[model samples]
Target chain A: MKWLAASALLFAASAVAAAGGGTRTNDDAIVGDGFAPVLSAYGFFSDAQAQRPAAGVTPYRLQTPLWSDGAEKQRFVYVPGGKQARSRGAGLLDLPVGSALIKSFRFGGRLIETRVLLHRAGGWIALPYLWNADQSEARLVLAGARVDLTTPAGAAISYAVPNKNQCKECHGAAGQVVPIGPKARNLSAEWLAAFKRAGKLDAVPAVARRVPLWEDRAAVPVADAARGYLDANCAHCHNPDGAASNSGLTLTWEETDPVKLGVGKRPVAAGRGSGDLQFDVVPGDPDHSILAYRMASLEGGISMPELGRASLDPAGQAIIRGWIAGMR
Target chain B: MKMTTALIVAASALALAGPLHAKTIDVPAGNNAQSRLQEALITAQPGDVVQLGAGRFALSDGLSLDAGGVTVRGAGMDATVLDFSAQKGAGEGLLVTASDVTLRDFAVENTHGDGIKSKGANNVIYYRIRVTWTGGPKETNGAYGIYPVSSSNVLIDGCKVSGASDAGIYVGQSVAITVRYNYVEQSVAGIEIENSRDALVTGNLVTRNTGGILVFDLPNLPVMGGGNTLIEGNMVIDNDTPNFAPKGNIVASVPRGTGIMVMANDGVTVLGNTLANHGTAQVMVVAYPKAFTDARYNPYPRNIALGYNTYVGGGDAPGFPGGAQLAKAFGGTLPPVIWDGLGGPKALLPSADVKVLNLNLPAQGAGVDQAKPALLSFTAPPMIAVPGNVGAPARLEERIVR
Candidate 1:
């Protein structure tokens, strides 16, 4: 939980350094400040088109993944041989230098984009790579791209691939980039244990309260399912130290204070995004809650998770609505 | 003496760093502006100048700069324009996360969000920048125009911002802010200093906004305990624009034609200002008008000092509730100063010659039903003496002067 790795982006070099050593993933790409120009240059995959990981690359799943316009995600944690990631109680795992986290977003069986969190000498740096139309390889797209496609909800939308700095907008904490998705509570217990047994993690973390699996949310309490979704999607930027800290709305799972969590809390600088509505979350009224309202918006300034998601997630919106509707 | 020496060093540093190892990169406005501008921002190092050329640069996504000690200069506010009307992604037009940055001579129009925002960027200067909505004042306009938050030693001068749903120039959760010589119109709050300490607002032409200038400290914010600000030497006039801010926002409650308002803050002095044509009182001191549960929050305005200022052609058409009743007691119109009677004895001190009204309310968040309005004749404005910490550093003042 205390892993506030020093500034990984402080020494990002413009040149593409040599990626030497490591028969699996490229060690130089993970250890150095230089960013690889191509996604395949990092060597995290044996069969890039088939989504197959190399020898040391381990695939894992989050309990409730971030909703990216209903895109299917394939996740992997790449740790060098003999180096284990430190597992805190419930916070983000402390990956050593020369480690990387990879996530690929796929829509309609086609790879759209892949984001990588590389732990270098200084800190963690987040980079986005866009896959070509052939699905054979992906190139580094620091400027980001927009693909016109149909979402899972049968809506035609222009999906945005976040630029490099936009990657930091969600991943940054106190001006430094850090990983957000690998918190112990957000990861499944089985995955954690298996990863530990595989010598990838230092130890299996014990989560006091695990977030519910999004697919099986019906079996859990409404608050857990809904709050879990929020913790995974909104908490990255909404936490106190995150990019949207000025808004003072912290959505972390441990943020139990009602007012701090935006319950009946008035908007300070929401502007037109507030829909002239009052309170971020009105008890028992999902329609009036600004949280639900922003989640459903597709406009540039009005949308929640402003950097990502050009289209709305109806299932995610329903979870937030359910949470607010159950509140009293 | 120590501060003067430090400021001299700061000025010297700025001058010395300008020529050495500093190269200017000129970027002309044309197709592929989004990628070109964004790439220039990324490749720019410290002491580099990203010069924007004349003409309109149409952008789709928001651009950001993270390199410290860099300057983004444009041809002119009118000549070099960044139009974000077709924006598709990002929250604001430009987001700066680095310190010691200078953004100047740029016009940002029709942005889907804030025009230019510098967060956690200390020692930032925004000079001669313009942010406007061509469609005029509407509820859909972006929130803030010149927004610098969570930083120290900030300066915003010679800027023009209009049609913001929120404040035109907003400095929040920051310290040592100075907003001066700016023109702000058709916004909810012309220039707002919120949840910050040691601010100076002066020499601005603030007109046609819902409220001229606001000094507020609200609850549940990351940074609180705002105070020690001076609002002075500005021509605040005709701020009668209807509040077009979205509902639930704090600024939406601002009464139309509000000249100057200080709410829930401490040690704020209102002095040396020219005001006119406000339907609300020219200057209002009130508490936070909502019920909050934060233990760290203080909802009362403390030690509010009001000075003698020029007030012209206002106080007839009152916007807030109970203004009619207060005007009725005065036989025609209300006074120039209005205080919500919630703070204790030390709450207010005003000039004797200046007319004052006391909205005698019982408690915080009380409505007009509990108001017992009357003119205050006993309270006298004390001599205004603020701490030396107020306003931006002298280094910033030197830059504006040059």
Candidate 2:
């Protein structure tokens, strides 16, 4: 029976078991063991505002809304190919600093949605607003989700939910450090106001919640941008226990401290007769940038971040290339 | 009464028995072939043939053979398919790590890595095997279609290979190997022989690769270039494309685009092979005897010969042999041959002068079109190529299924 369950687990990732768009029927339900219980199928607002949410709960006056106004007028952040139909939002929940949110979208009742909590280390930092967790399966985490703090009313709030594994899978390194480059994590106005009051930013009135940051792009150096991209993409599997951890290209934002990250150094076990290409970054030219060439390739030889995504966005690619071009 | 009943029953049973026939295993089209293949292999004996039905079977991992020797032949090349589309990845399609293995027909498509690999096994014959990556001919592939390594006494005959990230048919560190009558195109190297001895590569059609045929003795391998080998009867054509692999990583070790290159090797005979418009050189020999130890084997090839082969230098320019087919793409005239090895001056007999043999056979000619003279000659004191000194065509005519 355990083997049966294990074999059934392999098919779940390949084929979704949820009944949607008439894709599932009674027969398909038994195609594999429908392990989890079925929850309702609805969007964020629809599911949250329902009279009863799974267990008994009534909706009170809503502290925050899923959308600005209840219409499609709220634009999806434009990814290169399509709109943000697949993106999810995360921010300081009004519930409490340590509160957890466990929402399950109907994958045969498997608890698919996860929200992580983190206490602010530096003064309250607002992640530059962009699409961070841009997938249905993304486990969105809040930096303040686990802070052991007293509310203004003096009520002790602690993170009640269990810790998540997928957060580390997604954010890799700099896990709780809000990713503020390239894309945003859909920060909320209440969180922004709290951060400003806490003196995290130079004071600006917290009106126009979803104001676009189309301001002249800040002059962050290319090195920072390239490092940020590497942290976001490569650090996940390049660390210890990762498949390429042995190859020693640690791209974690913290580990890539330049000196530790082999940026200006030659690689080990590279350029052997086993057909290994040597030198990940060759300083200056993109043609000389082995890392950049590998990132642009699809063959198994050089393609990095071997799973999940396809090609890197052209604009993102340019920022990394700009950094490599500056390297000696 | 008992004897009479027994005789009647025996006669009836004998009458019911039918003629003996070979067992036929049928794989219906669109069936899961990974499991079916496993079952067939388990149930089959010698001389048993499994007919794979048409259409693609989304296979998981590669099929492994545990038996001593057997053959898996297909009805049509494209008809029987093993697809690794959703199976993540595996080493290769069919892995034969045992001796006396024979696999022919059918095609392995979309494998994550190598298409077919036989590692450290000998007495293997791969006939009419077609291994591709994109389900069809496609450039951005993973690596070698037919790759055999660390083995000996192997024969890969009458196979069609194309679109590998690495060489199409690569034989490395093996001896007494025969690779002939194959059509290879659009790969990094059509046929590559590295650190192997007593091998014969003849009667193959090679085109549009980074190099048609490459013989390299890589530094830091256990085997030096194998000696006393024959490279003949092959239609080696323009191999001008850069290797399809990403340039940054480890592939920088191999120099690109030489039709027939002998690097750090000896006793190599390049005879009766038609070479046309190869980038860099039609034939290049880098005989570094000191490099032999770094190449893993001592006593490297001490003799190399080139005889009786035609050279079509592609476009209208003076090439080799008094400079007849040298085109402008060859970077003016022809590249001068420099023996970057031991016996450097002595290897150029009668003169210490360098020479790059140009192949300038007319495109439309009688025997000269298919046949050509060898580019260079080498007869040192110690080593000799097979059959002593004989002129033979490198490529042989292929048998078309039509």
Q: Among these predicted structures, which one has the highest lDDT?
A: 1
CA lDDT of B163 in candidate 1? 94
lDDT tens digits, residue span A198-285, model 2: 4332333333223122121135656765665565456555554332343445765556345235554333222111234345665677
The segments of candidate 1 whose C-alpha lies over 4 angstroms from its true place after superposition are A1-23, B1-18, B379-381, B397-401
Q: What TM-score would you give candidate 2 relative to the actual structure?
A: 0.47
Instruction: Write candidate 1's Cα lDDT for B82-164 as tens digits.
Output: 99999888488999998999999989998888889999999999999999998999888899999999999999999999999
| Best-performing candidate as measured by DockQ | 1
The digit string of per-residue lDDT tens for model 1 on A127-184 reads: 8899999998788777778899998788888888888888888898999999999999
Worst 10 residues of 1 chain B by lDDT: B379-388
lDDT of each: 0.87, 0.48
